[model samples]
Target: MEKILVVDDDLGIQKQLKWSFAGYEVIFAEDRASAIAQLRRFEPKVVTLDLGLPPDPANATEGMATLEEILELAPQTKVIVVTGNNDKKNALRAINLGAYDFYQKPIDSDTIQILVSRAMNLFNLEMENRHLAAVAPSMDKIIGQSESILAASRKAERIAQTDISTLLLGESGTGKEVFARSIHEHSLRKDKAFVAINCASIPENLLESELFGYEKGAFTGANKTTPGKIETAQNGTLFLDEIGDMPIGLQAKMLRFLQERVIERVGGRSEIPVDIRVICATHRDIPGMVAEQTFREDLYYRIGEISILIPPLRERNNDVVLLARTFLAQYNEEFKTKIKGFSEGAIKAMSQHKWPGNIRELQNKLKSAVIMAEGTHIQAEDLNLTFNNDALSIDTLNLREVREHAESRAIRNAYQIAERNMSRTAELLGVTRPTLYSLIDKYHMDDIKTG
Candidate 1:
């Protein structure tokens, strides 16, 4: 049976509701304190909040405070604010502050019951939608809701419909492979294999043979004819990561395979036809490499028929917090921890981070923090950021970049100057303790002396 919490000052009205809504196990509260107490204890999915309570039954002061506290603690619970007689002003304010709905009335039993039923139905529907979204595949794995990421996602889908050779460009750990797999999932070749190889991870001598299979006795250790990634990925998609690292000599061979959908086993002349689509990704500056006569311009254009540049974490506003929350939820489930969300200071702190390692870095921080967070909310101290100086060298001239670097350096210096005294550090900088605390997040000075 569904439970309902009824909060009102008058005993006559409360008693009337208890009998009127006999279908539900209704609980009663005469003041804001008892109402909130019942709310936390019961975890009721539905609440009939009154805008008139004992402390300030005249005005909606106490009632409004109760409403705010209820929503803050349990945002998922539907709060239907019961407004005063002809008090439309406070009623509208309640709705704006995330109340499920506002009901103004002399409290007709049937009408209020119907309203409560409507809120419950909506709650059930939303819960279903959330469950479906969590299990959905592909780009669903890409967590940010920022417009920048959504735009890139839409573009990736458009490219997926066709078999054009695509190139994913982004800094390391921005989820290049995740986007690649999303393309494969929605593409015509969804059932077949999606093979991937990193050019940087494998030795140059073995990379050529790794992509193009060798015949038995072709090499000293070749005991049997083993197919390479391209052949292994026949009728599927072959993802060549770090494509810029392929030797200049081998680039011509790769171009030949792309230009004609065929390959020759290393020591054999049999023209093996392969019906496979090729996708490549590289963080290295291929165009610059082409100008320097290192990377072949011809091969560059072939693999980049459709190019998608993944926006870095810092460039995607609001995405940092979005990704952080997503990672927090994921870690909570994986670690069997019940950490709720980020602190206000933590959100601001995460927002300003440069995230040199991008999504991978953010994910790592949260995974460790969820395990370490002692409180219900993961605070700035829990994230323990470590600034990577290598990312700062990219654009030292930009004022924002320079300022961010300077601030981090100053904070580190200030903490040391004050002999690890956080209060003294704030006083020395002539800012309040709270302001200094937020600055610690802005700079991600996690390891700095904060005693």
Candidate 2:
């Protein structure tokens, strides 16, 4: 049921309006204090506020105070002010203060009811639109409007229309899965399933079977015929995450599947034709892997037909704060907390630190902060960011050197938090596990023990 609050010092007008809007669960507040109390308690979506309340019934001060408090408490709430005759100036002021609409006194029940209902309808529609947009597949889910991410998304959208294999190359936590899903959603195969699998998660010996399935008794533990991930993804998309970790032996098989659009199950001689679009992602340097003979050159060529490189979180200016706000809102709804938003220091720390772990790291940190935060706003200390001190330090060399230093610190902190579990660390940092491993290799931080 929609709740509405009517705040007026006039008992007769309140009674008339209360009985007029009998359909709604109406709340009454005769004074500013009680009005605010009712607001915080009821959290009404619509409010009919009279600008004449106790302590200032002759003035608009109390009423304006109530209006500001209501907006600050719930900015989304729609408030319609009821003013006295010839009170156009105060009505306009109330509107400027964020009231939805205003009505002149003398209380036409029919007219005021229409205004309240309209406000309710508008509020409901906006809420529904927000809910729908959240579930809808759009670039909005990418969560950043930074120049780099926008440019990457624009390229990704164009690549989505093509049927050719497209590889997403990015450090872990950069939302490679989100990019792949976005591609699938925007592509012709939007209605089909999007199957995602981590190539590195599966063991070397069992990875092939997991990809191409196995016939009964194919291996000692293979007692039943099972379809592999590739076959299961028929008529849809197969997102090969962490493709760099795929064993060299299976890389040839994957390349063949891409070439011929066919696969043969383990211990089965019959060839099974599969129709699917392939989108692979990796944080590794495929060229380096190819040179090292660790990843197949043919497969690399096939998957890299089109490549989208996702920039690290630190490089995307202002994206850290954007993503943090988005995550705070998400977790607030999930946890049913009234966390208004992040504090100034939190935003500063987020903006200054090198997000070595990327979006994923930001998400985890925010989730923790939201849950652990004592007040309505999340502070920098709540994030437990190790770079907080460095961000405040004035002793810095060149800009590039400072950036590198911050990046190194963020990476080290993320590694410690994940206890050096590359997969978990990758998750914390918002990169793929393989990407985390690659970072470990890049930074030569493998000697760091899992905390």
TM-score of each: 0.62, 0.62
Candidate 1 lDDT by residue in tens digits, 1-451? 7788999978888998898778788998888889889988887878998898886688888888999999999898898888754676787678667787666656666557656876777677667757856654346666666788888887887888689999999899998998888898888998999999998898889998999999999989999998999999999999999898889999999999999989988877798999998889999888999999999999999999989999999899778986787788788889888775775446656876889999999998899999998755676778885333324555358664466556656666777899889888888887666556545533434455333
lDDT of 2 by residue, 259-343 (tens): 9999999999999999899999999999998999988888889998989889999899777886787788789889987666665
- How does candidate 2 score on lDDT? 0.81
The runs of at least 3 residues in candidate 2 whose Cα sits more than 4 Å from the true structure, single-residue gaps closed, are 1-138, 386-451
Clash count for each candidate, listed in order shown = 0, 12
Regions more than 4 Å wrong, model 1: 1-138, 386-451
Question: How does candidate 1 score on lDDT?
Answer: 0.80
